[model samples]
Target: MRVDLFDFDLPADRIALRPASPRDSARMLVVRPDGLADRTMLDLADALRPGDCLVFNDTRVIPAQLEGRRGDAKIGATLHKREGPRDWRAFIRNAKRLRDGDSVDFGAGVSAIASDRGEDGSWRLSFDGDEPVELLLERAGRMPLPPYLAGKRPTDARDAEDYQTMFARKAGAVAAPTASLHFTPRLMERLAAAGIGHETLTLHVGAGTFLPVKADDTDDHRMHAEWGRIDAATAERLNAVKARGGRLIAAGTTSLRLLESAARADGTIAPFEGDTAIFITPGYRFRAIDGLVTNFHLPKSTLFMLVSALMGLETMQAVYAHAIAAQYRFYSYGDGSLLLPA
Candidate 1:
């Protein structure tokens, strides 16, 4: 399908620069088969049935954005994927200034040698240190905010906490699973009292998520690989939920993509570990998840395409129209939507 088909006009002011206070206070648009309803994140329990399970991504965002210099030349890098204990593949801001085998020095005693530029133009960088790379990042890296937000303002200490979800534990992701940012302890308590179960998996969301789709057609767009994991126990429990006639609702696109990657043709989810570059588009049949709770996405983005595939293209277009007119926020720090197709 033509990528232009997914384009929509969004007022600049509609983009959220910061998240709603008290997390759960953020508005949620419930997209049902028949119509749309405006609600809050707190109403999630009421929107879902007791037998439904909400799948969440627990991958923690790392301070992956780095500003450094090589021989007085300024350079910026955003680490996307871990190639080894000390090696990471990163997208460079001033890539033309550096070359393979060139060493870039990041302040605070952190530095790396660039090598093996990929077909996508990202370079493989191997850090120079005996200490764990995580520690090195702590001293020199900044949170990798989405380019849309970063372009508007600078990242600050508030974003350190705001960008992370309460479920964050296993660290690796460069980008936060923004939809999960709306969850809070109080919300979880309410969900439990309502008998709505929740489970977690890991998908280290990469900086690639912020990349724009420059392709004229959906078929030409390529998705970047991100690491994810699903344990056997979790898989068994998820399968049981389906067997007992319960719906599996993904908390974000990250969780949905990982679930779909692990799903068998028969719709059974199995244990999985490794990278997934799954590109969901319209006409694709979903097997693992029954519904999705996700943030508003960019125009002509792969995420919009994924949602369009989940619901119909026309349905999603209508959904966005309602969201925009209603003044719901947009992008990573924006409001969310609960998509339940009939």
Candidate 2:
């Protein structure tokens, strides 16, 4: 399909600069088969039946945004994927100024050598110290906020906590699974009381998630690979949820993509690990997840295409039109939508 089909005009003011205070207070646009309804994140537990499970991504956002200099040239890097313990693949802001085997100093004693440029224009950055790379980032890096938000304002101390979700544990993701940001301890307690169980998997969401679809057609777009994991125990439990007639709703596209990547043609999921470059578009059939809870996405973005697939193109188009008309926030720090297909 032409990428233009997904295009929609969004007002600049609709972008959310900060998350809603008391996270669960954020509004949620529920898109069911029957119609749309405006609700708060707190109403999530009551939105579904008791046996339904909301799958969450446990991957933590790393402080991967770095600004440094190589000689007299200024450079910026956003580490998107881990290649090794000390090596990461990063998108460079000043690509023309960098080359293979040149060390870039990122300040606070952190430095890396740039090498092996990828077709996508990202470079491999191997840290210079014997100390863990995570430590190096702690001294020199800032949270990798989505470009849409960062372009409007600078990242600050508040983002160190706000960009991370409560379920975050395994640290590697450059981007937070923002839909999960709306969840809070109080919300979890309510979900438990309502018998709406939740489970977790890890998908190290990369910066490519924010990349624009410059392609004229969906087939021309390339999705960047992101590491994810689903152990046998978790897979078994998720399968059991489906076997018992319980719905498995993904809390974010990260979770949903990982689930779809692990699902077999028979609709059962298997233990999975490593990278997934799954590009979900319209006409794709979903096998693992029954519903999705995700943030409002960018125009002509792969995420919007995925939602269009989950529901229908027309349905999601209507959904976004309604979301925009209702003044729901947009993008990573924005409000969320619950999509349940017929």
lDDT of 1 by residue, 34-95 (tens): 88889999999999999899999999999999999988789999999999999999999899
Regions more than 4 Å wrong, model 2:
none
Clashes of each: 0, 0
Candidate 2 similarity to native, TM-score: 0.99
- Locate the minimum summed-lDDT window of 10 residues in model 1: 142-151
Per-candidate RMSD, Å: 0.6, 0.7
Residue 253 of model 2: what lDDT?
A: 97
lDDT (10s digit) by residue, model 2, range 1-342: 999999999999999999999999999999998999999999998898889999999999999999999999999999999999899999999889998999999999999999999999999999997999999999999999998899999999999999999999999999999999999999999998998899999999999998999999999999999999999999999999989999999999999999999999999999999999999998898989999999999999999999999999999888889988999999988999899998
> What's the residue-level lDDT of 269 in candidate 2?
92
